[model samples]
Target: MRVDLFDFELPPERIALRPVRPRDSARMLVVEGGAAPFADRRVSDLPSLLRAGDVLVFNDTRVIPAQLEGRRGEASIGATLHKRIDLRRWQAFVRNAKRLKPGDRIDFPQGVTAIAEERHADGSFTLAFGGEEPVEVLLERAGTMPLPPYIAGKRPTDAQDREDYQTMFAREDGAVAAPTAALHFTPELLAALAEAGIASETLTLHVGAGTFLPVKAEDTEAHAMHSEWGRIDAATADRLNAARAAGGRVIAVGTTSLRLLESAAGEDKVIRPFEGDTAIFITPGYRFRAIDGLMTNFHLPKSTLFMLVSALMGLERMQAAYAHAIANEYRFYSYGDSSLLIP
Candidate 1:
């Protein structure tokens, strides 16, 4: 389909610069599969909106401070580490890349340095740290939170972003971007869901910087999704399958979780143990075999995420739902309001 079909005009003011004081206080737009009136709700109302037998799958991948400002000779350079190829090497998108070349040394703050080992066709570089210290340690010494350009361009990343950009379930670190929908969840909301008998499970999908990349493709067929590492253990897969066997709905809390689930699920709709990379590009006309519903943040116009949601709920319905969200002053983007899309 034409990428222009997904385009819409969004007012700039609707982009959320920061999260609400209490995370669960954010607004949620409830969009049902059919022609039901869109419901204005709150994140705290999730328990009430979902049934007792339903399960919510969360992405537990933690956001790393992947943004780095450094210098090579006289040229200033910026890098956002998106993927880990090994213990010491990372795939990063580099700014001022024209000034860099293979084997060039870049010095970052706190005495951290790396060699620009190779440049890929996609314009990213393979950066290998120049110390025995773990890459995670090097990042801690020199990196800042990798905020989405939409937000970072508006304001500088600060100490507050270190806390705000992480979800309650964050544990296994790797992701450059936060699974924004999961950020709306809090301990109180978890307690409520537990009391309501709504089960929660976790999977990992290190959301990469590619999530923030714009879809420059004129058609959906031309868009290539960047691969991200993900994992689903056998125990978790068994539990999810059992839940579905018991007539429970498997609701993915974010597109990250949904994509990983779909990647692991077979044509028969059974989820298996998986630990590898997934570059699943979900678009309209795709068959969803794993998730019964999704909870995610408002996405950018003509973004792959919007296309994923459109696939789940139909293009026209999502377009109308987004129109309602905009008209009602709902927040947009990574730090924006949530939406419960059931299809």
Candidate 2:
């Protein structure tokens, strides 16, 4: 399908710059077959909406404060870690790429320094940190949360965003972006879901900086997905398969969870344990085997994420949904409202 098919008018002012207070206070729009698929509900009502036998799968990957400011000689540079290649090497994007060359030494906070080892064709460079402390620990001291460009313009990340941008279940650290769907879930809400007889499991998928990168391809099919490391453990797989055997639904908490599940699916549609980098691209003709439903935040217009949702909800339906969301003053994007798409 043409990428333009996913295009819709989203008012710039409607983009959410901050999360709603109490997190779960966000709105949820349910799009299921039958009727017009226009239901008004709160995110807090999620537990009650799902059936007893359903299994909720969430991405436990935590966002890192990967955005850092540093100086190369006298030139100041803004850097964001794209992904870690190993203990020391990382692929990163630098703001002043034109002035940076391979073998340039940059000093970070806490006296940590790195040497640019290689330059990629896209202007991103590889950096190898020189330190004994874990790179993550170093980043914690030197970096700030990597907010999307849209949100960054509105305000700087204060104490509120330090907690608000991440999910309550975030554990394994790597993602630069938050799984916005999981942002709406609270500990109390998870407990309520458990009390309602719904089971939950977690998989880790370190969302990459590429997620926010705009699609340069005019045709959707021409686009290539950025690789992000992900894993589904044996325990989670067993529980998910068991849920399927018992005729239970598998509800993915976000697109990250959905992509991980789909990437690890076996021949029988049962997910298996998987640990590797995945660059799986899901466009309109992609058949989903593992996820039954998706819980995701509203996405940008003409984005790959928009295409992924269209694959499940149908392009025309999603276009209509976005129009409704806009007309009703629903918040949009990372810190925005959510939707439950049952395909």
Candidate 3:
């Protein structure tokens, strides 16, 4: 499909500068099958919407403070590490690329330095840090949360983002972006789901910084997906299969979780424990596996995520749903209102 087909006009004011006062208080738009528009509701109403024995799969990868600012002599560079290639090597996006020559040293505030080793065709760089220890340790000491680009002005990382960008079940650290659908759940909400007999399971998909990058290609098929490390352990896989055997629906909490589960499914759509990198791109016409329903945040127009939802609910229906969300004054993008795709 042409990438332009996903384009839509969104008012700048609709961008959610801050999350809702109570996270679960955000609005949720429900789109079932190839249905008419959407039925609007609040996120807190999720428990009532789901049936007993339904398995809600969540991405439990924690967001890291991966945005690092550094300099090469008098030149400034904005650095964001997307993934760890190894213990000492990382793939990163570096701004002011022309100012830094290969082998030039870039220093961070918390005593981290990156030596630019090579540049990729997409303008990102391969960086190698000196010294023997792992880079994860250095990152924990030096980096700041990689906030979405829409957030304006210079600001320090504060108490709120530290909590808001993370999910209640977040455990492993790697993702630069949060699996936003998981953000709607609070400890209280999780308990409520449990009491209601809704089973919860977790998988890890360290969301990559590529989620923020725009689709530069004119055709959807031409767009290359950025691979992110993910895993569904053996135990979680077993429980998910058991839930399905009992006639339970598998509800993915976000596109991240959906992508990981779909990537790990076998021919019969049964999920298996998987540990690897995936660059799976779900566009319209793609067949789904292991996801019966999805709870997710609103997405940007012309984004890969928009295409993922379009794949689930059909393009026209998704367009109408997005239009309804906009007309109804629902917030858009990360840290925004959510939607449930029953289809």
Candidate 4:
């Protein structure tokens, strides 16, 4: 389908600069797979929205401070680590590429430095951090949280974003981007959800910097989807399968979790142990096998995320729902409000 089909008008004011106080207080637009008018709710109200037997799947991948500002021979450069190749080397999208070359050593803040070992065909570089210690330590000292460009371009990432960007379930660091939908979850909310008998589980999908890249293709078929590493352990898979066997709805808390679940699931809809990369590009006409519903944030116009949601619901329905969201003053983007999409 033409990428233009997913386009929608969104005013600049709707873009969230920061998260609402008391994370669970953010607004949630409840869109069911029905003709019912969209319901306005709060993130805290998630427990009341589903049955006790339903399961909420969350992404546990932690966000790393992957955004770096550095210099190579007096030329200012910026890099966002995209994927990890090994213990010390990372695939990164670099700014000021014209000034960098193979073997160039870039100096970052906190005495951290890396050598641009190779440039890939897609314009990213293989950066090998110069250190004997773990790269996470170096990042903690020198890097800032990798906020999406939609937010970062409007304002500088600050100390608040360090806390705001991470989900409560965040652990196992690797992701450059936070699974934003989970940002709405809080300890109190989790307690409430558990008390209400809404079960939850976690999987890991190291959301890469590539998630923020725009779809440059005119058609969905031409778009080159970026890959991210994900995992589902045997125990977790067994639990999820058992939940479904008991007639429970499997709800993915974010697209990251949804994608990984779909990638691990077989034609019979059984989820299995998985540990590898997934570049699943979900679009309309795609049949979902693993998830019964999704909880996600409002996405950018013409974005792959929007396309995925459209696939879960319908193109026309999502278009109408977004129009409703914008008109009702719902926040948008990474630090924005939440939406519970049931389709």
Best by lDDT: 1
lDDT of model number 3: 0.89
Best model number under TM-score: 1
| Candidate 4: segments with Cα more than 4 A from true spot | none
Local accuracy of candidate 1 as per-residue lDDT tens digits, 1-343: 9999999999999999999969999999999988899999999999999999899999999999999999999999999999999999999999999999999999999999999999999999999998899999889889999999999999999999999999999999999999999999989999999899999999999999999999999999999899999999999999999999999999999999999999999999999999999999999999999999999999999999999999999999999999999999999999999999998
What are the clashing pairs of model 3? none
Q: How much lDDT does candidate 1 score?
A: 0.96
lDDT of 2 by residue, 259-314 (tens): 99999997679899999999988888888899899999999888889999989878
Candidate 1 lowest-lDDT run of ten: 133-142
- Candidate 4 displacement at residue 250 in angstroms: 0.6
User: What is the lDDT of every predicted structure here?
Assistant: 0.96, 0.89, 0.89, 0.95
Please rank every candidate by lDDT, starting with the best.
Answer: 1, 4, 2, 3
- Which wins on TM-score, candidate 2 or candidate 4? 4
Off by over 4 Å in 2: none
- Comparing 2 with 3 on lDDT, the higher-scoring candidate is 2
Q: Candidate 4: global Cα-lDDT?
A: 0.95
Task: Please list all clashing residue pairs in model 2, or write none if there are none.
Answer: none
At residue 258, give the lDDT of candidate 4. Answer: 99
What does candidate 4's lDDT look like per residue over 39-77, in tens digits?
Answer: 999999999998888899999999999999999998999
